[model samples]
Target: MVEALTTTIQTASLILAGWCLVSTFRDRPMLVPHLVAVGVLWLLVIAQAVVSAVLMSGGEGPAQTLMFVSYLVFIVLIPPACAVWGFVERSRWGPAVIAFACLILPVMLVRLEQIWNPAGV
Candidate 1:
């Protein structure tokens, strides 16, 4: 179960992304979708950070350690920063910004998987 949290993080990110997509199509308030998607993204990213810290402390490889730490920094900052920007914009593009973050997360997670196990690569 060394890489189990990666799966959890991926699932949560996908769910938030799906919610953002659905809300975008339904024409919901920009903030609603933004908050919902960003909220979940934030939670999962934080969890990932914690998990990464634990794994690194447990003596994972240098590449895996560094990758998770980098993703932690990105994941922690992006969503909240997007939330603030989205709030200020007050337009459809608000949620669109969140959707963009969702796009970034999957790539990061896949990289995270690689980080957890470069031997698999």
Candidate 2:
């Protein structure tokens, strides 16, 4: 993954996580704005996945291609799954769930980056 894209993803994830956290603390359930933010984040993730796949296929990415792909697939599924769960729960915990999921994204992305560029610390 490119450094700039990684930074963007990380920043976005942090922002989303913060939003979710604030919503949860304010006793808000999953709302339209939250869903929209998640949607945008999902699009960003998909774009990154496509770019990474292309890079990998061109022999420009990590040698651990299978692991990278697995992470990509997992990352892509997180937001929607959490969204559904949050919607179903319909409580402050709903936003809490999203908060946790968003928190996971940054860690997952960092792991994906490490898999893609194993040489870096």
Candidate 3:
């Protein structure tokens, strides 16, 4: 967990997700940029995972690899989940689901950071 990246990127994502939610409520299905923004958010997440894994994997410390994999699993799922749910619904609520998930990113990132650096935090 990259604390700075998590805080900054996730907060930015929250704003974008808020926009997506607002657009969902006020506009058509295709008008929202929720999927695109979520994709970008995942890019950051993947990067964070990769960096953490590489650092932890090389060291002699007791790094829990499964935790990183778990974060990746959920991080990877988020974009597609949002896309499918949002697309299938074909309604403002589609973006609403995405918006809700976007709002969750920061919290999840924070948790991930805590997992990585539990003692200090």
Put the candidates in lDDT order, highest first.
2, 3, 1
TM-score of every model versus the real structure: 0.78, 0.94, 0.81
The lDDT per prediction is 0.69, 0.86, 0.71
How does candidate 3 score on lDDT? 0.71
Candidate 1 lDDT tens digits, 4-93: 666766677677767666766777646664576677768877777776677677875546555567766886787788777766766566
Error of 3 at 48 (Å): 1.4
Question: Each candidate: how many clashes?
Answer: 0, 0, 0
Expressed as tens digits, the lDDT of each residue in 16-111 for candidate 3 is 787876777696573445667767777887777677767777772225557756875786577667777877888767778778778877777776
User: What clash pairs does model 2 have?
Assistant: none
lDDT (Cα, 0-100) at 114 in candidate 2? 90
Candidate 2, residues 46-117, lDDT tens digits: the string is 888888888877879888778888999999999899988988989899988888888898899999989888
lDDT of 3 at 79: 64
Candidate 3 ranges beyond 4 A from true positions: 30-32, 60-65
**lDDT for residue 38 in candidate 2, whole number 0-100:** 84
Regarding TM-score, does 2 or 3 come out ahead?
Answer: 2
The ten-residue window of minimal lDDT in model 1 covers: 60-69
Model 2 earns a TM-score of 0.94
